[model samples]
Target: DTAVSQTPKYLVTQMGNDKSIKCEQNLGHDTMYWYKQDSKKFLKIMFSYNNKELIINETVPNRFSPKSPDKAHLNLHINSLELGDSAVYFCASSQDPSGRPPYNEQFFGPGTRLTVL
Candidate 1:
């Protein structure tokens, strides 16, 4: 099986609807994360679940919430979605944080495109 995978590759909804994006990673050794890629191709981490704990990136807005049903599953819920919230969400997994490029290497999932109208 692949290291990471996500569901619902396309999501289109109105501004006020609530939605959830699911992500699963064959994660271990404290290295799995969620990131958002905007239309501009800027990538930013939204959350990281490492060692069975959930860590949300401080830069992410409160509307974006990461729910970890377990150590290996990381999901996202967006409340009161807005037009600006549209983006491609990706889930990724790695082996560890060794402060090197190899350790930082991540196997990414097929992204979910969420378009809020």
Candidate 2:
């Protein structure tokens, strides 16, 4: 079984269009995240949800919304999609890290590539 899964691995749309990507994980992790990988291959975290609240990176635009209906699912919604929004988005999950014991690594999905025309 796949640890993480995303629907519509590839997305193509014109500028100003709206789209949404769905993601689900069965890893039993407490934290889920949304990451964006630019054309240059630079990956950066856009949002993180730790079982309850969401932590968003300040650099991310308001047009991008990440919704976590539950601990095992995270969905991304983009409004007024622009050329700059064209990139690969990844969903990742990780258990809570323990400084007193050990650390846990994050598991990411294959990625959803969005192309804006």
Give the clashing residue pairs of candidate 1, or none.
none
Best by TM-score: 2
Query: Each model's C-alpha lDDT?
Result: 0.81, 0.86
> Under the 3 Å rule for N, CA and C atoms, how many clashes does model 2 have?
0
- The TM-scores, one per candidate, come to 0.88, 0.92
* Candidate 1 Cα misplacement greater than 4 A, ranges: 27-29
Model 2: per-residue Cα lDDT over 13-49, one tens digit each: 9999999999999988878888999989988988888
Query: Model 1's lDDT to the true fold?
Result: 0.81
